[model samples]
Target: MNNFARSEKKRQHAAVDARQVLRALREMKQSERPSRVRMELPLPQAGVENDKIVYLGKHGQLADWSGGMRQRFRATRPLVDTLLEGRQANFAGLLEDAEDGVGVWACDGDITVLTHVADTTAGLLFKLLRGEYGSAPTREGAMVCVVNAFWTDGGEKVGNPWEFKLREEARDVLKAGSWEVVYCLRAVRTAAGVPGTIWRRYPEPWLVLDETGRVVLSKEGSEEPSSAEVAEALNRTANATE
Candidate 1:
């Protein structure tokens, strides 16, 4: 072959090799991207605005209630789909069996979905899960507080505690019905930040039961028991069990 022809062929081969490498890199990146989980959050009776769930305030104003669930709550698509189908019995059975039945965490007096103190994301989850607005309301039930201190490094920081309210209704078959109560005790993000903006999620998103015994993400923190103190108590309980 002529020298110029040989040079042109070499250039073409190099370009093809570069294109293949780029395609491979793109595929690898796509595979690395985590699959997003769908959450089963029911909308309030107030309905949606600007593609966001909203509720009418006591003062006749509309407030956005999407909160952290929209930004932070993560789960598998199949799990969410199952919950939506009204078939969370298996999941609930798993959670019930997941924890040892050696301890009890129950609530007292009237159940309040939100502390209504600072309107945190946890508070929003409690309201949405319990159907405090336009959705179905919770019936007679018991309560359990699930505390997770993993993010706090063995309860050092003490993430928020979740109130798992178990509601009960008469049915042909017996099942567990649960809901969540929210309290704004500790700030999920203590650093300086602007209002109406979602910061990092503190503690951890956990499973809780609603009025229908369906599994849902429980809200964080509480006003009365105090999330940090609750976690400490839970730690003590774990130690005692061990």
Candidate 2:
């Protein structure tokens, strides 16, 4: 069959959670309210007009539409089928899990999916094996750090402490050549009653071979060793230049 035929056949076989489908349709019923926008932004990068941006509902359901145009379109089975396919639709966070467990599409508050990504391509189950992770959202506990800093700069940065530090470090390394980009799957969660895995496109979550030949992430504050530990590791790696 042709590509169009294949796509049609796939949609014909598409299936999604029944409970999610019902809830989505119900939200559509509620979204038939009034509008509240003075002027619309017409930037494609802003995604004011495009394939839907989906958010995970409480019960692994999907909030089909957003902004002022809600309920303007029906949340039909065909729509659900298209989303399940994940091709044309813009899924900023939502995805298809190859492994079996709790993710953005979980039924309850439990998360158990294969996180061994970096190998599996699109259209598969989620699983956690090794070398890297994808994501699983569960409310275990959160952390707030009390770091002892020794600053080299004259000002404190507005973002994460790691960011300011990385900027300082990259100034020296980036002058050399290209960096070996590492692809990683960073685990993420949310407290907006919606939590799950978030696949990051940047190598900040993955292992990178730096100019000094050290494996590291740009801003994984806790995942990497402390500064003192790294100094020791580097000292050990250096050859005697006699």
Candidate 3:
């Protein structure tokens, strides 16, 4: 009664333990596996030409203009006279003779230009510009917007050196060991009849590191520095260097 009963009891206990172990293993595998997502966002249409000129007025409304209409504005004698007197327009040669047949204009912080043939697609440009601007000095954050210019080879071309005034200043903070500029790049537009059809805009704060390697200007702050702030930082550095 003792030996046989003990052997049978042990066998039943072993069978139950084996089932529990198998169940636990299956649960663990299920927990570790990534759930499959059934729904996905549709991709935007590609290879479409956006030739409309959109001007963001001082009041923040967008005004659309045709290429011919824009050219008419350029033909105005008084405006041309004023531009020549002020040396505002970089019209050293005929507009048709311009490289890549593009023009660029900046009003306050808003920029308007012709689109390029290569970088005009929206999604690719957005990703490239996001990488350049979404980085913080020592942290990570998303950008509000990034405008970019594209080279013919699908590479983002840096805008005019003057346009980089803010980025250059942000670099100064890193140079002074106060911050670090982790990312910088250009946005490209390939839409037709746009001046510079390609331009670069900074949509994110420049990443930096303080002397102690601390993050100061993070994206989550109540106050993030603007391009002007970066320019100011650069100016301070320039004065110090001088």
Candidate 4:
């Protein structure tokens, strides 16, 4: 068989094996299959920042590393309790509080993100405010983004690049942390015609990728997953089976 044909056959076999293994596990009742937690809270309304600590993306929950602009959405509870709940949640790194709140920089394989101590709308909190991430061209195939917000004495928004003025302690922590990160700041125009800078985070859909791109996970317009759901989708047509 051709290389493409061989790879396609292998992927199909892998998918079939995955389904069988999961079925066996469920049948044996050894452990429950992993699933997404659906505990998102009401999102924060816009125009609500009155010296507010921050913002969030996606149903008011903590930001996922991908989905591009969805990072600006916020959630009402801790993302770790849901998204990264159980073994997927990594807690091995420290991120200095933003002179405001407390949290840790978590690493999930090649992925690195932050999770806060508490999930309150007010008081000391590590607000997931909006910013830019992967706006620049780089050797890495995928782009990512996060924006750190600061305001001026007159309450005007003073732009702060993620690369500039990082706490020394935080910098040291990142140096030896999960992934090796070395990035330079780049300026881009904001929607309001002002210039700003952003820091990139790990790419997402969690752990599904290959030589082509993303492996399929779900059907179109489906609200919930089905029994056939697999992290990597089968990405080819079947043969005649002669």
TM-score of each: 0.18, 0.16, 0.18, 0.22
- Per residue, candidate 2 scores C-alpha lDDT tens digits across 1-242 of 12211232121222222223323322343234111100000111123344332233221123333431122112222333333343222222223432311122221222221111111121122112111233322133211110111122222222244665444433332222212211111111233222122211122342222223243223452133333443333343333211
Off by over 4 Å in 3: 1-61, 68-80, 86-92, 97-242
> RMSD in angstroms, all models?
22.7, 21.8, 28.2, 18.3
lDDT of candidate 2 at residue 230, scale 0 to 100: 37
Per-model CA lDDT versus the true structure: 0.23, 0.24, 0.25, 0.25
The digit string of per-residue lDDT tens for model 3 on 86-134 reads 2223332222323332333221121111222122232322332333322
Error of 1 at 215 (Å): 26
The 10 consecutive residues of candidate 1 with the worst lDDT sum are 193-202
In model 4, the Cα lDDT at residue 82 comes to 38
Residue lDDT tens for model 1, 187-217: 1111121111011111233322221223222
Model 2: residues with Cα > 4 Å off, grouped in runs: 1-109, 112-224, 240-242
lDDT of 4 by residue, 153-237 (tens): 1211222334232332223322222121111111122222322221111111212222232333323321222212321122221
For candidate 3, which ten residues in a row score worst on lDDT? 36-45
